[model samples]
Target: MDYQVNYINPEIKLSNYTGKLFKTEAAFTDHLLVWLISGETKIIQADESFVFGPGSTFLIPRNQLATIINIPKDGLPHKAVAMHLSAERLRAFYNQESIKQKNTVSKIFSFHKHPLLESCLASLIPYFEMQENFPENIASLKITEAITILSAIDKDIGSILANFDEPYKIDLISFMEKNFMFNMSLEKFGYLTGRSLTTFKRDFHKAFSITPQRWLTKKRLELAYYQLTEKNKKPVEVYYETGFENLSHFSFAFKKQFGFSPTTLQKIKTNS
Candidate 1:
């Protein structure tokens, strides 16, 4: 099927959504980006599991296997847009003859904040829903905004080319992905990361804009959703697998995070 972005412009297309966990090794013919609006996805690349959440963006390289994991049951409302840059198109769009011909395939990247990109997504609904004038150009403008933001924010370039790089706050996130299934606790995490509990907690909050407990709570909730919808696992199994103390705690937390009880979500899934 043609991706949604294709209809808007010949250069880019948005793929359709599959509600369940997506486990595929597909290839992208053009440069692609998936804007995840909600829920969480564990994208497995080689030995790495990259956890992508709301407002997260990832790249799919041309002709590569992208094994998507932990597709949320309440499949996140998301949009995937791709662009196949041509020399003519590049010149017309940016008035630049030399847009770098980088072989960016199947790579993962993140943008914590980009106003143009944020604005583009905000306008997506109206741009598509209303039968307004110059929709193509308008959507094109949004795509351009996304491209511009990406160019400005992509840090991989300077680090590799200039050899000057600093650590990102996401190093902790990488550690979490590797150790989430283990008996990981706040104290243990602090110890492993070489910081005192108080300092670690403060730094984590400053970095993610949420307390570590809150972050762990959200992560566990996401894990539970994945287990419930994708794994077809029992509630008891989910509770323990997600590191919850008991069923009561799991149910309470699940309800709070998803606005529906686990049983209710299961029933809906079964019926559908």
Candidate 2:
């Protein structure tokens, strides 16, 4: 399979991939607007999962953790156009507007076949070819159009887009339990949990009586073991989803922790 990403600028891109499925854990720093042109995408969050087929458009709020899977379906590659709605731009846009902010929870907002959003995103397609000469103001205008459309469609969007506060202190245990499957640095985890690195380590020790790295590895490997032995899932499928970066690393860690390889456990479970 071939993979390509064309950037009209740092904020806008067109992605095309053929053959194999691609998966990754992402922590979005800016709000993302994605318009799928072909194939399928499944976004798995802490509490919910969403699947978007061809022609689906959605917005993912910033400072959120998710596992994204892109699959090539029906002989077509997984192709999509993504626009990043940066915080800097949003703050500037809302400053001159008289929009009221409301408190809202972070979640993926799907705009299914919305004509306005489709038109807005589709207009950017040609700009991918004009990469070198793409006008900055034109991109800004499109983003403004998108923000306007979103505000008009959803009344509560003002809060999500305009409220730029960092994550407040959250329950570390609860947050970690729900989001342990995502592979992120300790620093990122600390920031998202609303604590400094030192505070995070101190709090984590008080809560779990173990180092963060040790706790995370133990939890991930236990989950992987359960998935292999009880769920009968493939090692390939379990590794990345359980927060490990690669299969070899996952296998090594799994063996060291459990005294047997994931594949060995799977075979034993199957034969028994």
Candidate 3:
């Protein structure tokens, strides 16, 4: 499908002035993140009801049904920022697998308070609605800051972005893509981003929703799977080249994710 990458990561859409009682359900094509500022708003996800006050945020996963309830109409009411992000884009942006990134997902949905965040969200509202003259470009940078501020306010999310901020995160992801075949360590990753191990782990989870180890393992295994099946590489070659220390571990993880062992999948490919 043709898609816009502008809203993929740290993208923001802001609107000032009051909100009215939402009379209809709103659905998104991707993950929806809403930060409520000032007044009170109610969000309903399935049977659950979330009451967001002045510093509360809510997340709605892609294709999920959600409703905005109790939108206040009194006076200027509340100003808010909403973001729509794709799972694939987020995974690619962080250079990690989407499945292992639970902490990152949690942070995206979690809500908290930050004066700087509020101000940033507030400032972006105008730009978000502009829809002209590099609006997406400006909004993309602003959204990156918004995500960082969100990470700072929440410890869980902090784990994901620990190694990333501003220009460095973008650069680091590019570096990883180029060096995925190399022997990368926590120390090297830390040095690349100027973060300590502990800090990196924390932010990694917070931003990406997956531990670095888990992400790396999955990446390696995924590459191995593609090579064994598509490239017709031998299992031993795939295992060693993918950086797995042990063949058994690689097979186990591969089966766990793909629902079948690599040997089984390869045989099926050959038979077909």
Point out where model 1 deviates above 4 Å.
1-18, 73-106, 131-134, 155-272
lDDT of 2 by residue, 1-272 (tens): 37899998899999999957888788889999999999999987878889999999999999889888899999999999999999999989999977666658878998998999999999999888873778889989999999999988888888899988899899999999999888888898999999999999999999999999999999999889988988889999888678898899999999999898998998889889
Task: Report lDDT (CA) for all predictions.
Answer: 0.57, 0.90, 0.58
The residue pairs found clashing in candidate 2 are none
Give model 2's TM-score versus the native structure.
0.94
* Position 143, candidate 1: lDDT: 62
Please identify which of the two predictions, 1 or 2, would achieve the higher TM-score against the true structure.
2
lDDT of 2 at 118: 94
Highest-TM-score candidate: 2
1 against 3, candidate with superior TM-score: 1
lDDT of 3 by residue, 1-272 (tens): 11112222254544444434432243444566677765676654433556777777665654334445435444645556677555544544456423233445422255556576667656654454344454456655665666556655665553443322222333445444444443456765655565677876776677668877877787777788889878998775566556565569778888898899888988998999
Over the stretch 151-244, how does candidate 1's per-residue lDDT look in tens digits?
6677443222221122223466666654454335576567655567787788787768988877778887898899899988878656655656
Residue 4 lDDT in model 3? 17
Best-first order by TM-score: 2, 1, 3
By lDDT, the best candidate is 2
